[model samples]
Target: MTDYAIGDLQGCHAEFVELLERIDFAPARDRLWLAGDLVNRGPDSLACLREVRALGNAAFTILGNHDLHLLAVARGGARLNRKDTLDDILAAPDREALLDWLQSRPLLVRQAFDAGGDTVMVHAGLLPQWSADEAAGLAGEVEARLGSERSGAFLEQMYGNEPACWQASLDGIDRLRVIVNVLTRMRFIDADGCLDFSAKEGLDSAPAGFAPWFRYPRRDDLRLVFGHWAALQGRAEGARVRAEATDTGCVWGGNLTALNLDTGERIGVSSHLRR
Candidate 1:
């Protein structure tokens, strides 16, 4: 019963299936931890969502920025961008079910290892100030709001880059926004420990005084698994914590990647999309 953590699907259904086949995944025996972005950007958003949702209890998924964007757009909180490929999902017959399932996902997931330590999964990265347990607790706050009747209103105010840093005193929408950004949209952090949303290219494209979030020292023994920065191409080393990057940019004509949490093995399937 191995647990595999997969990178962002981004609607690449064929590659996703191929990767599962390559790994010989059996839902009855093995469990999957998905790093989110289950839909959008690639050719088959609808199919991807269906496939994951059908996995049921065998799969655990955290909410990515793209996933949240889909929910927001569906609820009239945001508009689709030119590059988005989420129309199929929006127009699907089970759109409501899919969106509800997605909205209920948490921003952080943690699993403890029998050998000690833990594996923490998030769509992007965690704020330097947050420990694994603290992040999970904060994520629950957003999950509650998203799963409630006022979710549409929360989604409407979910966008933005303000309150760029974490503060215990933060409340209301501002606090929720910070938690969401750190767990979903985060890539780099400035010297002051604030999130830098401007850079998305790669490590070298980090804004002045900013570096990848994992570079900061974390006083925990947990391993971190995350997707979202495809530019890393599934590698980010020299971090204080044991961080595994899983997004191999399958939507950008790269490979779909999965990491075996128990064995420290990585398997990848090349994307069919032309570069």
Candidate 2:
């Protein structure tokens, strides 16, 4: 059984399907790990979500910023950007079911191997202070709220970047928002673990006294597999920590990519659909 970690779908369903076919993926045998942003800004988000959901246990996923935005928008808590192509998804007959499936996806996924190896897959980065286990627990805090009966209320408060850092003392929306940001929107962070939202450039562009989250000393705990930062493509790595980027910007006219978790092998399929 092969295990493939795919880059963000970002609504490029055709490319996703093409990549699957190129790999000759058999859902009955092979497993798939999706890094999220499964919709928006591309051609066919509905199809992407439907196809991935159809895979059932053969597929594992995490939530991305855009994916969360979709939930917010669907619940009337957020407005759609001009570039957003989610109209089709929100208008689909199965829109309720699709959004339900999406909101049900966890913010972080921990894939354990009996070989004493484990990898944490999140939409973005994890705070340096938390170990993989702590991170998963942190994620659960958000997942539980997102899947609750009042999830729409949670989405209404999902936006904002305040509290810019982690503090166990935080409660309510602030706590959940920070957790969501770190696991979905974070790219660079200061030495004190305060997230820098403005700097989205490569490593050399890190603000003074701030560095990529994966470079933090304490991050070596879990082998992290994340995808939100497309600038690094599929090879974003750190000095010692295992932070692998799978978002190759397929929606930007780039090729879709997949990385094999166990074998460290990667495969690509050129995007034939318009971004």
Candidate 3:
């Protein structure tokens, strides 16, 4: 009956399992909130996807940039990069089911707490211009098209960083692309709500015009939970929003983190890799 929010898996299946064990997670009773990137860059992409998919209703996962990239590559819209370890997933016997499950995941996850407020989880971060409600609506827009006939054409259009800001008037691929970026890859956002893609370090190293997303005015209206910034190592400021960055860089030999939703308690387990 407990809920735990986990950081990126990134194909580190062993660490993922160990973290579950450490937390004494029960697949039948405990619900897991995964912060995305369920596959890629580590030893067992297929295993990670299958394990999470096996959780059924017990797990709620969002789509990370890597997850979308896998979809694009599977649909023939993109090539497997040199560093990608996703071939096993693409070649698996249950590839269709796995891909379908992954594709069906939402871009935004909303859970109501007992204290009368709720938390919204996205893979990366939200734009300053968006309220949690607006962002959830926008996420549904991408979810609708991600696995449809239009996705083949839109997947190719999904790669760019152009139109780096969100606009109500944005139409077609431009709008979807911006939504995907902010939800999956954003780290810093300018005061005007423009995304900054260059820097990956912490807030102190922010580029001249940008600041971390949680620091923006009124961002605490809805509590935000996110992953994808390994540099943060499970730490994000802005207590008002309870902003939590759970990606502890397990794929890079750091630990995997899980947060207790009701208690706001965080626990970490080291990566299985000897690195």
Candidate 4:
């Protein structure tokens, strides 16, 4: 089966459908690794969520910041931003099912290959201190909370930037928040390995003493695929680790991109949104 990893959908359903057609995707024969942010900021949030959900086992998704924000808002844990286009999803008849499915998704997914390397997928980037397996374990900590009875309470506490640095002794909400941030909201990290939420632009916009997380030294046995940094336009690499970016900013008038994991080929479809 062909495995294709696509960037953040961000509610651009038409472009998503077109890209699928371009790749000649067959649900029975091909698998999809969606890099998250499946809904928000574009015109068709509900449709996008529905289409992906219908794909069932054919599609595997991780939660992005926007996806989590949607859950938080629905649970009264966060407020809607002025630019958010998530109303359609929140108001849909299948909203509960969608949100439940989203919350049930893991923060990290790893696919092992017989060829001696694995592909690790996250919505954003990994911390310098985490090996892929360690990250997966930490991700499970948050996933357990999200899938438990206290999930609503956890969502309420999931919205902060405090405790920016990681520590082995961290526990409770602080620990969960750090895991969430590193997996979903991280971009650049300070010299001390603390997350810097200041910049969302390209590499040139990195704050002083901070650099893209992928640039730091890490394990080399896995390929890290991520979305969320739209300004990168599907281009990012690291000296010590292999990283691939797939977010091409479809919601911001750029093209939607998908990377073929096995063949390393990229296919894209232009956004219809006016710039």
TM-scores for all predictions: 0.97, 0.95, 0.95, 0.97
Q: What lDDT score goes with residue 251 in model 4?
A: 94
Tens digits of per-residue lDDT for model 3, 1-275: 88899989999999888899999999888999999999889899999998999888999999999999998899747999999999999999999889888888999999788852678899998876888789999999999888574447777778788989888899898999899999999988887889888898876878998888877866446768899999888888653355878899999899999998888888999888766
**Per-residue lDDT over 1-275 for candidate 1, one digit per residue giving the tens place of the 0 to 100 score:** 88999999999999999999999999999999999899888999899989999999999998999999998899946899999999998888888898888878878888886643588899998877788778989999999888784547888788799989878989999999999998899999976669888899988898888889989888877788999999999998668778889999999999998888888799999999996
- The residue pairs in collision within model 1 are none
Per-residue error (Å), model 3, residue 10: 0.2
Off by over 4 Å in 4: 114-116, 237-239
CA lDDT of each prediction against the hidden true structure: 0.89, 0.86, 0.87, 0.89
lDDT of 1: 0.89
Q: Give me the displacement of residue 245 in model 4, in angstroms.
A: 0.3
| Model 1 lowest lDDT segment of ten | 108-117
lDDT by residue for model 4 (155-208), tens: 888979998998979999999999999999999997577998989999989988
lDDT of 3: 0.87
Model 3 is weakest, by summed lDDT over 10 consecutive residues, at: 235-244
